[model samples]
Target: MYLLILGLLMALLKFLEFGFLAEVSWWWVLVPFGLAALWWVWADSSGYTKRKAAEKIEQKKRDRIEKHRESLGLHKRRH
Candidate 1:
């Protein structure tokens, strides 16, 4: 995501003839996008994305359970 944003910014700067960026090659300016795509491919193949998604779901479940427990006066609030 960061890489994609960086790539877009670089491309924009290059297109607009911004000072230093205008002097850079198109290949250099487009590298971040390639990196971002590679990152996505690696994350998907390594199950990183799936694990992160599962972690989010688990956190939501825990939060819901804690809320229910607190409502029932069975959970203590952290100081």
Candidate 2:
């Protein structure tokens, strides 16, 4: 699916005969720019990073619980 759109873009660029391709000599710029834009969107708006942060907080709570139990000498406390 993505490949089709890419092919069409390249074909259009060729058809238009945009001379920027030759003067800029940075034909690969489009790929990196697209990737950076994607990364920014996904990293900023997605829940993946939020979930990871939540997991870290849960882990810290567990660690604090273990420390509290050790301090109170209740390592073998039953639930």
Which is the leading candidate under lDDT? 1
Local accuracy of candidate 2 as per-residue lDDT tens digits, 1-79: 3644674565466557665543443455256457656766786698777888999999999999999999999888678
Q: Where does the lowest 10-residue lDDT sum fall in candidate 2?
A: 20-29
| Model 1 per-residue lDDT tens digits across residues 8-77 | 9999999999989999999999999999999999999999999999999999999999999989999976
Give per-model TM-scores: 0.94, 0.47
The lDDT for every candidate, in the order shown, is 0.97, 0.68
Task: Write down the RMSD of all candidates, one decimal each.
Answer: 1.5, 10.6
lDDT of 2: 0.68
